[model samples]
Target: MTAVPQERRIVTAIPGPKSQELQARRLSTVAGGVGSVLPVFTARAGGGIIEDIDGNRMIDFGSGIAVTSVGASAEAVVRRASAQLADFTHTCFMVTPYEGYVEVCEALAELTPGDHAKKSALFNSGAEAVENAVKIARSYTKRQAVVVFDHGYHGRTNLTMALTSKNMPYKQGFGPFAPEVYRVPVAYGYRWPTGAENCGPEAAAQAIDQISKQIGAENVAAIIIEPVLGEGGFIEPAKGFLPAIVKFANDNGIVFVADEIQSGFCRTGQWFACEDEGIVPDLITTAKGIAGGLPLAAVTGRAEMMDSVHGGGLGGTYGGNPVACAGALGSIETMKELDLNAAAKKIESIMKTRLTAMQEKYDIIGDIRGRGAMIAIELVKDPVSKTPFPEAAGALAKACHAEGVLVLTCGTYGNVLRFLPPIVIGEDLLNEGLDVIEAAFAGI
Candidate 1:
């Protein structure tokens, strides 16, 4: 197979003739609700490049929303998944158990934090895994309430939309959402009223206080949070915040669920982000990077909690499709073989060095945060005021896209420009992408 060259080659204007034609066709056939960051349509993608239908190769900095960390066309993933697909595409685990499903669960049990005996249930999407985690937590604790944090993103399903913090794109017009879901404050350092240093302890105290007075701890089944928030702009809660919340959950017998869907599987320089704070959650939800772009997700937690749900209580027809399980196993293998964790750390070091330098030069860049390859720059109207400058972010992204660099903008205020470059990306390509970003900022 011809691998996609790790080079940026802009042969046509962003959405070139072919891509424009496809976009026109897509507008007529695809749902209006589905949005894309760039106007160009992809023809092939591999390594750190996405080749558009018009033959323009752009540097990939989004990783398909961090789902293709092991690379879109990892050799191991392709080999294993292809082999499994050739053998058989489906044999629903619920119908006739398969080794691949059991193997994936075993991997989750071993890889996820905590030494205690663990169990996992597979699903088809991040939202599904989160929904099931809540089910298990509620069943185990016999509670009716769940607590989440501000600026946290879980997923798009009804229950997840309720769990998610943003409104316009994710939760708008989707209510009435699931009941008994409460949102509390997060240790958002940049915008915290008290300042970044005090954000951790104060935010945790306030969040726990709200739970105690507003929603009785005894009634709360789970407190789910992204160790490093994803669509909520990759906000890693202030230090000590997660630990304090974990302690409160332990004290109250509530399940502490770390939703590591976006920050897990070595994306943050470690197998999981919670490990950075030495947090061992009672339950954890994972997806995205787990299956090398295949549709797979999982909820892994303490054995007793997972076993609390009665048999036949949880499952779906295509939950752990054998092919997806194979892909996940292969993805894990590739992660280990390539030592992608170290690669992610290197990317983090390079990005921080460059972004911090950019922050100094640009009054619009208010903050630079995130870990490993999952880094971001929050744009502001001006550093002195620190007012969110979403318009600047939009213009910057468009300029980069026009120059053959693919980036993504997120955050509740839509002012954060996030980068999730594949760990396998070469130093030269990574720096080139950053140069494009820097040039865009200069124009601002």
Candidate 2:
């Protein structure tokens, strides 16, 4: 493995000769449905930089889609996972239990929002955690309908695709989706039909009203939403919207599930995004940043609700794999020692300052939203019309990449430039990356 210096050094063009050759091979072998944001093949990534095969280094604004909050190959995670790998790769927890899996669950219970008694079940990905959360919610509540908000993304499975609000590459031609899934209004401050000031109360009321009249609250199993929407742009639900919905769920006996996969584990300046707002969810699904880039996710919730599932119903063969569990434990230890929450807040401050300055200059930046290190700028044709400018977003991302800064663009309308820098990224490197973005904006 390369000991990549945590600095951007574009010695060659981004997808330099070596990567260009591999790109051609990838197109031939990899499926078309699976897409990549950056074309260059990564040699090593850590801290704030991704070193490509050709030795070109680029600042990592996307933390492997927010999976590596403690930095992609943090010493703790690698050390622990390596030890576990050498000991025994997998006995399968269902077949033979391991301490690491239980330990990961313990961390989840202690760390996830709500002071109530909580239990957790681990899985291989965010989607599995989400899908299992649905199963548990339905089992406990004996309800059929699952409600998700507009501009929210749950996962890619048939069921999650239904819960997810976006269409395009995610849901298009993938249905007939799982039934009993209802879509409601999200308090998207930027493009809310009702306007930003009224988005919170109005959207919450409409969502609650729709459930009451159409789905009937009694029929609802869960209301799953991302605290700060990811993939459908980084749309944070306006203040009061989440609390209102949680209240509705409480009144109706519907499970309040927060999909915190992208916003959990100190990525949002708190252990979890919901904690900042004091919005306690009955169930929370986590992945992404949970294990310092390992493929592990968990559904942590109230003890009784999680216990509702039959003994063998909630797990998969690789659920809480010993090595992943080790990684997660190590990841958690790193988070505590590093106080990555404070780092996340600092990232937010830097981003807020730079992006706010950019907004002052650029008419294309319609709105800036998100919390902690998970920030985004919604590009629009102009602030007046607020029409999505997906093309401009693409151009800006391209320019940043060429300048040795890896910026990611996402959104419902493909108009959001989301930055998920590692919490450990240094201030100097961070500012340098921002300079690239600012220059990109100036050129575009």
Candidate 3:
């Protein structure tokens, strides 16, 4: 494989000459509600570097929101997708099945967390995969209620909005959310009601007890959770919390789902985050990095459960598009060949070392946490008090962007700076990104 670019080149101010002109045009052509993380417009990206229209190169720390795991514009992904395009683009799997679709499903069945007799279905996005998973669960269990955790973000669809916990953006103005969805507490140790150190199995048990009493476990169709909470600050569940929830779901005959949308595909040093705890979920929903930036999502689960839905009940016009499946196959192959799990671990080592040093130097960094390359630093006004420093997070991210590094901020309170470098990122480029972060924090 070719090496990643080693340096970041900043030729102009961040929304450089060309990008500023495009940004103004975009404001008129696109909806004002649409947002941009960094003002720079990309001309090209490969490995860990994103080259902008102004000829400036920035180190990419946010891998397209944890997609593009093999690196942006991966050669293998581009080659396979191009080859598949030469043959055909889409026949719609629902209309005419193809080998690429079957091949992608076969790979998913073999690689997902569980070893049970598994089957897979592809969808066009993470939201669709989530919605379909609920449909299948409700059909198989013959139950109406589906339970999702607080701080968990499923998608933007009406059904998924009901499943999601955030109020703004996704839920705002999208009222009258789909019925039969219930919300429960997630194992967020940082802000857990019981206190961080004490919020393990007991907190989870409390939440489960509430669900069993309030929603009645018998009426629940499925209990869905992110093995590591994405978008909601990358909160990893406390040690015993996940297994406890799984036990509860099993005892109550409720389907257990793991939302690995952002944490799967070796982003968390494992194929799936649930593997960290050795807990096999009944249904695994994945997207983001699965296809190396193509819009492909999947729900892989027990054969019988997946077969519960009627044939025509689970498909989209663009579900499992041949080109996307081809990309997925190539991305998975690249992941295995490159040992991206090991790469994620290496990223974790670098991040932990650098972030720990930052924590010692800057009191604004309240907490440093996450698994593997999927790490984050929570900013706070008072480190001892743990009060979120939203302004500081925003300022720090802006500074990093100005200095030619791209970083993303996420959290319920919007005070967390997340690092989602591609697993294939080079050591020199990764360190360069870290240096920019250090410089940004130093100014604060």
Candidate 4:
């Protein structure tokens, strides 16, 4: 087999010759509401590089927003998906079910961390998985209220919009959101209002207390949270917060739901982020990287909790499409064979070393934090004051892109630069991308 190239190849401007033509066509044919992060239209992708329509190749650090942990086009995933296509495509899992679905579910049940019996239900998107998990919690607990944390992003669905904390794009004109949903403060250490150096546990306790007093835990269906807040700036909760919340939920009859959509499948150097705390949630919602670029999301949890909703209530028209299931199976196989968990750790090691050096060199870098491959660098006008610099972050990102490196900016204030490189990325390519980031900051 031939080895893959690591560094980026920029033949023309970002939206290169062919991509410019496609962009014009896309404006005419595709919906105007559809947004794009980068202008380069991808013609091919493999390992960790995306080949643009005009022959410009770039190292893909976003992994399609953490959806391709195995790689862009892992050989095993393509082979399995192609083989499954030869057999069948969509039987509409609800109408006629298939073995691939059951097999995938079985794998989920086995892989999900728990010695207790578990079950899984598949869906088409992370939003769908989150919504279904809420439904299951409400059905199982017979409660009317759902509690979510501030800066948490569940999805774009009505219920998930209610769960999400951001307001500008996801919820601008989409409301009225689903009813009986409440928002609480997340344990963000850097910019917390409490002013404690490490106030995650204290903040979580306060939020739990407030909810208990207002909503009454007995009437609360579930408390949904992302183990590591993804779109809200890759904020990982302080050490004691997760365990405290899990204990509170278990004791108070609230379903502890872990939205691992962005942090699962070894993205955080573990199967799930909750595993870092040794906490097993009642319901775990996952997607993004599960199917190696295919759209497949799942809610796996304690058997009793997962089975609470009646059989017909938990499915979608194309929930567990066979092709997606095959892709998922292949993805899981690739993770194991490639030892992605170890790879994630390696990514973290490299990122921490490089980012820490950058922080020392740049006063704009306020904080450097994250687990494994899921890392972020927060930007601020003054490191000591920690005032977010949204414009600086955006400028830095554009500068990196102009230099042929594709990077992403996130956080509620849009002041954090996150790195979600494919676990299969080569060390040299990863370092090169990091160098571009350093150069961008240096120029700024």
All candidates' lDDT scores?
0.94, 0.91, 0.90, 0.89
What would the per-residue lDDT of candidate 1 be over residues 1-444, giving only the tens digit for each residue?
689999999998998999999999999999999999987988899889999999999999999999999889999999999999999999888889989999999999989998999999999999999999999999999998999999999989999999999998998887999999999999999999979999999999999999999999989999999999999888989999999999999999999999999999999999999999999999999999999999999999999999999999999999999999999999999999999999999999999999999988888889999999999999999887889999998999999999999999999999999999988889999999999999998987
Clashing pairs in 1: none
Question: Residue-wise lDDT of candidate 3 within 1-444, one digit each (tens)?
Answer: 454455799999888989999998898899888788987888888788888999899998999999988988888899999999999999999898999989999999999987789999999899999999999999999999999888899999889998888787778997898888888877888777677777877778888988988999999999999999987888888888999999999999999999999999999999999999898999999999999999999999999999999879989899999999999998999999999999999999999999999899888888889988899999999877888888998999999999998999988889999999888899999998999899988897
- Residue 23 shift from truth in candidate 3, angstroms: 1.0
Q: How many pairs in model 3 have backbone atoms within 3 A of each other, for residues 3 or more apart or on separate chains, i.e. clashes?
A: 0
Output the better candidate (1/3) by TM-score: 1
Candidate ordering by lDDT (highest first): 1, 2, 3, 4
Structure candidate 3, residue pairs in collision: none
Q: Write the per-residue lDDT of candidate 2 for residues 1-444, one digit (tens) a residue.
A: 445598889889877999999999999999988999888999888888888899899899999999988888899999999999999999999999999999988888888877899999989999999999999999999988999888888899999988888888888998898998899888887777868889899989988998899989999999999999999899888889889999999998999999999999898899999886699999999999999998999999999999998889989899999999999999999999999999999999999999999999999999988889999999999899999999999999999989999989889999999999999999999999999899998897
For model 3, the superposed segments whose C-alpha errors exceed 4 Å read 1-6
Model 1: number of backbone collisions: 0
Model 2: residues >4 Å from true position, as ranges?
none
Q: In TM-score terms, which candidate is top?
A: 1
Question: Lowest lDDT 10-mer window, candidate 3?
Answer: 1-10
Model 1 ranges off by over 4 Å: none
Question: Cα deviation of 382 in candidate 3 (Å)?
Answer: 0.8
List pairs with backbone clashes in candidate 2: none
Q: Each model's TM-score?
A: 0.99, 0.98, 0.98, 0.98
